[model samples]
Target: MRNLWNLIVQYHIALVFLILQGIALTWFVGSHGYPRGKWVQRSLEWQGKWDQRMSQWDRLTELDDLNRELLAENATLRAELHTARRDGVQSTYQGAEVIRSTWNGASNPFVLNKGTAQGVKPGLGLLQNNRVVGRVVEVSENYALALPLINKSMEWSVRIGPTGPVARLVWEGGDVTRAMVYDVPRSASFAPGDSVVSSGFQGYFPSGLLIGKVADETPEFDGQFLTVPVTLAADFRAIRYVEIATVQGRMELDSLANSNGQQAP
Candidate 1:
């Protein structure tokens, strides 16, 4: 401690000079209006940058929430569109999300988050993005199973062209992007770009809903019907949201079939 005091005493003159220099520097800075203003300006600039970054962060969070809501809203609109396709077909529509799905198997099916509790039942048609997706085949309280169009046993009554006559739609079971339309009359001239739509025979899916577009026309082995290639509209691998349609006439039709012990013609 004594040695430290002695060293300070030896440097006291130099220290006083340093102290006077610091005071002078402080006075000089305080005397200048521009210097003071510059310091304040720098502080404000830093604050503004911080605020901008925080605001952008808040917007990013809000945008994510908005996107989810929009997806659900779009699902509802898809159901409404199916209802509008036919006048006399009494049906109810509701939106749902896919819980499980498989396209690589012979019997590709989809599982949804809604079921009998949500008014989903067997024979109800499933749709996504206003296009035909599948038909519900099994149901539980909170979940349901659907037979997608890509399934081998999956068949739908479809038309060759937009206003053309009825034909049967089936998946060829090889390429996921393509399917086959059978029983199309050879007399009807349809090309690759022609649209194929539903025929409303099942009363579940309304008539005139787009299924796909004709990809190619091939002469079937039977020669009686033209088996044409179709490019499916829905990409099964990317399916997310779906909607279920409740058809009114289906219950009555089911009753009649049960009473007669035979299916409807």
Candidate 2:
């Protein structure tokens, strides 16, 4: 208290001038209509801007919550759609967020905020906005590792169109938005905008799930087969929320295939 008193005494002249100046300004504004009106207007403007900023902050919080709800709803709908497509196809679909992902690597891998505890397991398929994104390759208690379509080491079984021939979709490691389908028959009737869908032979994704669209790039001829380019439907660079489909009979199918001396996809 003594130190504060000494400091105030040292700045007494400046403090007195500031106090008188504030009093004079207040009196001037209170006595003059124009100044009083301008002061009120400035105060209102500042308050309005503060209110607007608060409203924006509230909207951002609400938007995040709404997105989470929408993601969960979409996951439920996708699960129902898949169930309705096949009889006795017991699958559980859950919503997940991509916590980490890489699209610029030769073997792009992603991490999802789900794990064995959340029913996530190896061989499960991942989808974003109803489009095939990737498959879960490894799972732990609280996380899962997935390989996206951009991975050069991964190949997906896809068809050119609804009734078109099935081919092997593989990434060539250059463009993140595009992939190549090899062993596609030269006589396959498809145009630039034809859809490429999952063949379901791999037992990872459901049949007819959209993988990509046939790109406008020129096809390369490899003898009787054509290597066609495809524009992927899932945007790896923008992956946020995803749906994970857990096929119930996948293990059984794998077991049967192994007993028959065959590998399941």
Candidate 3:
């Protein structure tokens, strides 16, 4: 208490001057409102900017939630579409994201984010933007493996667009960028730009899904057929998502094969 009294005594003059200056400032501002009003307006403007930044942060948080909800809704709609198509009803197929790609000769397989749980199954046709990508060769509870068009063992029945001829699409083990369309007649008059599409002859895929365009054509060893080289429509190296085509009457094809004591080639 003695020290406090001594310190107060030492600063009493300086404190008196500060109080006098504050009183004079208040009197000056109250007497002339323009300067004080400008200061108040500037302070309010600064506060408004702070509030705007906070509002932007809140909006970003809301947008993130909206995006997640939309993704879930999309998945649900796809499942319903698959069910409708399988039941022989006309409906749109769902798009599934590609979670992994194994194009490095590891059986030439890819993994999709959806699986049997999402109505995906083995032998279902895989497509990208209405172009044939491949087929589902393996499935799990939450994932499925796809055999891309580059797979050496992959084969499909395809027909050229509009006026072109039908042939068997097969991949040659040596060339990854090119595939051979076999059994096309030499008289089909194929050119370098004919579009190839699925024939749906086997009922595994819907007819008219694009396969590729003819990059070149040459006579085959048999001298009666032409080997039409196709450039794949789907760029396997850049594929990000694909649609799984659930065709109607898949079971009928299976039954016919079983009756013949044979499986799909």
- The candidate maximizing TM-score is 2
Please list the C-alpha lDDT of all candidates, in the order they appear: 0.72, 0.78, 0.69
Give per-model TM-scores: 0.68, 0.74, 0.62
Model 3 TM-score? 0.62
How would you encode candidate 2's per-residue C-alpha lDDT over 177-263 as one tens digit per residue?
A: 999999998888888989999887677876788999999989999789999999999989989779897776878877887798874
CA deviation > 4 Å runs, candidate 2: 1-60, 85-90, 263-265
- Which has the higher TM-score value, candidate number 1 or candidate number 2? 2
Query: What are the RMSD figures for all models against the true structure?
Result: 25.3, 20.4, 25.7
Tens digits of per-residue lDDT, candidate 1, 1-265, equal: 9999999999999999999999989876663212223443344345434543554454467764574477678766655664676566655667776756677876666667676777776788877766888887766656666778888766788987667878888886878888988887778887787888888776668677789988865546466777888999888988866767776787787787789786422
lDDT of 2 at 134: 89
**Pairs of colliding residues, candidate 3:** none
How far residue 121's Cα lies from its native spot in candidate 3, in Å, is 1.1
Cα lDDT of model 3 by residue, 1-265, tens digit: 9999998899999889989999998876563212223443344345334543554464567764574465556645755755666643333466776655655562466666666678987778887767888887666556666788887655788897855666789877555667888888867876787789888765557776788998865546577887778888888887766777777666777788779887432
Best by lDDT: 2
What global local distance difference test value does model 2 have? 0.78
